[model samples]
Target chain A: MQDDANNPEKKVISDEEIKKIAQLSMLNLNQDELEMLKTDFGNTLKLFETLEKKDVDSVEVSYESSKISQPRRNDEVLHDNKTQKQQNADTSPYFNKKTGYFDVPPVIETE
Target chain B: MLHKLSLKQLHDGLKNKDFTSKELTGHYLDRIAKHDVNLNSFISVTSEHALAQAQEADKIIQRGEQTGMLTGIPIAQKDIFCTKGIKTTCCSKILAEFTPPYDATVIKKYQENNSIMIGKTNMDEFAMGGSNENSYFGLCANPWDLTRVPGGSSGGSASAVAARLCPGATGTDTGGSIRQPASFCGISGIKPTYGRISRYGMIAFASSLDQAGPMAPSAEDLAIMLQAMAGKDSQDMTSANIEVPNYLSYINESLKGKKVGLPKEFFQDGLDDKIRSKIEDAIEVLKQQGVEFVEISLPNSVLAVPTYYIIGPCEASSNLARYDGVRYGYRTNNPKNLESLYKDSRAEGFGDEVKRRILIGTYALSSGYYDAYYQKAQKIRKVIKEDFDKAFEKVDLILGPTTPSFAYKIGAMTKDPVKMYLGDIFTIPANLAGLPGMSIPVGFSNNMPIGMQLIGKAFAEPEMLNMAHIYQQNTDWHTQIPEKYTT
Candidate 1:
């Protein structure tokens, strides 16, 4: 197990680490929850104790259902390509005149 | 009339013109209306569309254009599958008003085979709970005894098939979802190897473990439905591209040379005496057919529940993040900001069980804890899989009681989620290993059905089905339904 210094004196989790985990989890924890997690983060680290014991070299990991691994799909575009703006602009749920974005109901409430 | 017929019998009747597809479909619809009000097995009954499809099937049959093996058979689909224009709520309030614009790959295959979709069945919200009580619509009562639970999260599918509401149903299993319910409800259900069926458009609970398979009255019926449901689809990149085996063709094969392994750990303490006796009886029957039983050890199975709790919920927490009340579904009434929107919408949309699992999962997969929980669970999961792999080298399949005990009365385990989760103890290892497993009726425990699970090596469902079929042929347990409930 790689033991890195966990900046114990720090009051809150570093923004970089928080951002990285948030992106992986797709969660938007508020400031309060994030603060709470700083103290609780050590508890989460307990899983490492279990993983560290495993002998990965002898694990013989097999993800394939069959012995033969088939080739992946060809990397050819079946249709005409669209501009980047054309792909990004449409945010409308019904229909978007801008950049082809599908705009659904707003996720947040306005004050 | 439809209620008494199995899928194979129904198909034969349709093919021989003994009964038209339209009449059979109507009969099933009428049965659903009469039974589902009390059983609470279905969330929505697509009677109009089902009848129309039956008419189309009749036309196809008349023209001698058979679409596939299961032409004109009525089957209920668990609500996790997104059926175009129908409410595809995973039995959660979050997706109460949500309707998908497309169909799950399994549903599409059923349509291609000319199967009549009876209705969408109820389930635990987001497939989170062991009991069907977690459903937003209400608990689906067991067909055998109204007060007891039909095990979940495919409880509705199992109950419907047991009560004969639909000849069969499609259910997704992440961790013991299909087999457990089949065990409780006294029917046959199979969870095929992970990636055997396409996950596209099926609201996923866990990416690595989630698999869709069939629940029905008999292993033969399950085999027939699995033929249509299994195989690769381009939409789901993870789908297995292996050749689809002819499942039905192997259903009646003899198991004389087969070796069935019984894991010693599974038969230890906590198993009910009645269930144990029933399993022993099943073994004797198998032995009479020249099938041998070998005792093996799965040292890691003791840790299966903990490993599953971490992995299933961790993946679930991630999978369910898609329901942010944004793209499509029920949104919070009023939210001051994005944070409140996400929190409140989820709080309101999800049931208590769903929230509890989400919290546990989030905690496990979080940064500081990832190694302790998720990584640890993954490593242990590997151990469980290795245990199975080593055992399979000496046996054609493994057999054990599907659950340590029979189904409990409603509200029995509702207060204790952990205890309720343990109901899946005997079954979850298969999902962890991505192997095909099934539950077939052996006998009764306290007059309720006792199911013996037959787990095969990955993609060995055909062999498992043959073994289960041999046992059923020698015993009358599969033929015995809850006598009083039929009235």
Candidate 2:
């Protein structure tokens, strides 16, 4: 919206691309939702077109703030206490008390 | 009568044996019970639990043990913080039935201080929207005008405090959540310097920018609440190991020689005329106290909203990928397989705005667009921070209108997400820079409260609070209550 040159490379995304994005996001969007997202993304992405005008070629990415992270703690294998484990076990349907392991449906499916 | 008492008065009352913690807690609970029907500010009102905690706090005071400013005080926690065995919905349907097995570090700190946990406040689900409308629990209203929204995602906390539902509440800011709502609802709130408070057990949305702080009636109360809430934690590595100063000690410090910058960019075209006039009046108050205001520029200020949306959604998409229906939170009733479970559960679990952010984030991080969107946004984020870095070189802190205008009507801005994102313009830059920022009640505009934001250099929270305290002393804005709720 600024200048034609400022908007030279507008990232145009397609509806098919929206479906793939929903899938990658693990969200099952219905057709209408997908259609809405196409327009939504188009409008939202236009905000970024403004970013291209700034000459930030030499600027480094800040994954976070300027503060340096605290030093890592040493790895220690401290087991959870019994009551705490029981409290956690109550949250899951598949916790195996006898085996001390949580069970899940087998990853391999035979059709 | 009790609800109107300042926090220090409540503490003194508890200490002098004038009223027990149970009585104080009961008074607040009763207020929330009666008044909250108009605001919907709470998701879970833990009345029984709160009273029980108040009883315990009474015992601690009875024993003559050590105590702090929050001892026996009742405080509301934003539902984003996981309270063990309490249904901690971040006002999302996905977590509507989800209760955590552990307390957030901020909650634990308050508990250690023997502060009573009144209830869990409502918020924009997963801290996604600029308004509380995005919540599954329903929209939270401004106490001043029930038809309008309390600017969110900390809307519930702000509204609750404004209506005297609770004395103080904890709110997390990713973009403008805490400050904006505080602005809208005519209360006070601060988002401490990044890592000033721990995030352990506080549900993440854009983990990089999310930091917790306090919302209260006044800046002095914020100093007390922040003292309890801040410090480093082993559970949150991003929490700064730096020492938290005695905020209250520094709160009463002089404002005579301190310099504050009024960014010309923030005061430019977008701001409402009334808000600008109020901020100028606030400037006069500060100037009378010998504080000087310099007109400065943050040239890239317009770019903050765009930069924050990209980074916020990207990290949110990744952080939120954890809710795949396996362990906790909502799961689809019957699923054919793991993939369907993940898809169906997430689709049904999240709201429209949340889904939009996840999709945008996913699309940006996917194979080809990562560099163009995510990486480019990160680079621009650095430029925004450097802009602040340059400004701080000349001024002690920055001052501006907390929102472009005061709170809009509930359904007014909900249809347009990009426009709603732009509304966060003034508050987003501070989150980007990892600086400490706060909003205090300045004056009223069109019968709605206006907030003035004070952003200090990183770790300059004491100065910010101190300066806010000075403004509050000179004006009665912070002490005013909504007329309809006054009775």
Candidate 3:
């Protein structure tokens, strides 16, 4: 396990890479924000690079509760359309709703 | 005077007719109205709802119905926990106008126990930052010194409790959100073992690490609150199916014959000299009480901060993907297309810290870098957990300082994200290992309170609470309130 903290080879995140990441994250960042993020991502990734130095070849990935297994529930509909409609009404103020459905841009274009 | 009373005292007072629940609730509401201006602890003060609940509690008490200690007690949620019809924002603009249709499991538990819902406290946006400065509302100042940040992301909860604005409040700890703020505010908070409390309605920051617990003036109050909040829930599959212990029963347990380990790694350089000495002095007090202390090692401790930051952000990236402008939450108006809508809404909604973490997370989990970053970090997380397990085999509990230093001035570490991440070095291991941990005020450094952390094995909260309660019995640090906030 080699410590990357002092390793001369640091992973430099480029502006193009940050742009790709923002696109994947569905976040719209302007030029100034992207510039700032490039520097921050580089610094943070350098810190994370040290993880490669640790001897974790045999360690298992930790996920979910250590002792508790995911409980299985009966496959049944708990809430009806009426209940869902009420919830939609509660959230209507935040989204554009028309005819009891959230109005969104067309997903497909006709040829 | 009512605000100063412990949960048990308040419950007894209610039962004895010394003060009605409405009166107690009003007293706290009045205090929040008057004092919360100086400390932006609350995001929404539910005055009307609180009064109505208090009135209902009075009727129950008047009828001599069997009730728990928390009944009729006024308390605040951390704003992360959803309450029916109350705006449950994670102190983030994305959910600023969003209201929950139902209560979180913990909130439901509190309601069932007949507790008054005082309000929702401010927090780090999406529980991301180390200081409350990341909140969309405003920075929640330390009650001790307004310029200093109340350590976050549970800063609002810690500040409200410290200022006596509420007798107790609910706080969620992912990384050191609960304990660090508890330490900074000179109060007590417990981050129960993962799955000890259900997280069905609590907004997810990091699903595997987030656990909601109580912040209050004393360990006894935390025990009472924990007793109510801890249990299995059908709604949360991750919640453990174990029986909830009566934490109150174990508060008086003697510390005699208990082996408390002092982790050597936690005492290394970077800890403030004054806080180190203060912890040492407190250890002396515990020593005099027949509790044995031994030097122990968590060899992989140094990697905790890096491991947590990677895993936390990665999970956050995935969890927060649901906040697209369509179903609920803040939606961008007049979008040309769905893609633009998502980009614009998130760009306009999330704060800088949230965006930073999301980017870091998105990058880590991206196609080429997933193996290098997220997977490797998860492996290191296992190593960190093993370190705790190995140490716990020889000791009943591990004790250390909660934070590396006293609370830093607001905006001091904001420029350096890594520096802010390091603030949680000592506290991250407990969350990493899914172990129960607590912070208790031990002494002061430069007029600011320092906290001594106690880390116990999984589900060993009763023993940990007993130790903290016994320690409090010998010290008055937890009893001391900031002079400025003391009415």
User: Interface RMSD of every candidate?
Assistant: 7.3, 3.2, 2.5
Clashing pairs in model 3?
Answer: none
Cα deviation at A46, candidate 1, in Å, is 12
Model 2 chain B lDDT-worst window of ten: B413-422
In angstroms, the error of model 3 at B485 is: 2.0
lDDT of 3 by residue, A50-72 (tens): 67788777777767438656667
Clashes of 1: 24
Off by over 4 Å in 1: A1-70, A78-111, B484-487
Q: Is the docking of candidate 2 incorrect, acceptable, medium or high quality?
A: acceptable
How well does each candidate reproduce the native contacts, as fnat?
Answer: 0.04, 0.58, 0.68
Of the pair 1 and 2, which is ahead by TM-score? 2
Per-candidate interface DockQ score: 0.11, 0.48, 0.55
Ranking by lDDT: 3, 2, 1
How much DockQ does model 2 earn?
A: 0.48
Candidate 2, superposed: residue stretches over 4 Å from native: A1-11, A77-86, A93-111
Worst lDDT window (10 residues) for model 1 chain B?
B478-487
Model 2, residue pairs in steric clash: none
Error of 1 at B28 (Å): 0.7
Clash counts per candidate, in order, are 24, 0, 0
True-structure RMSD, every candidate? 5.8, 2.5, 2.4
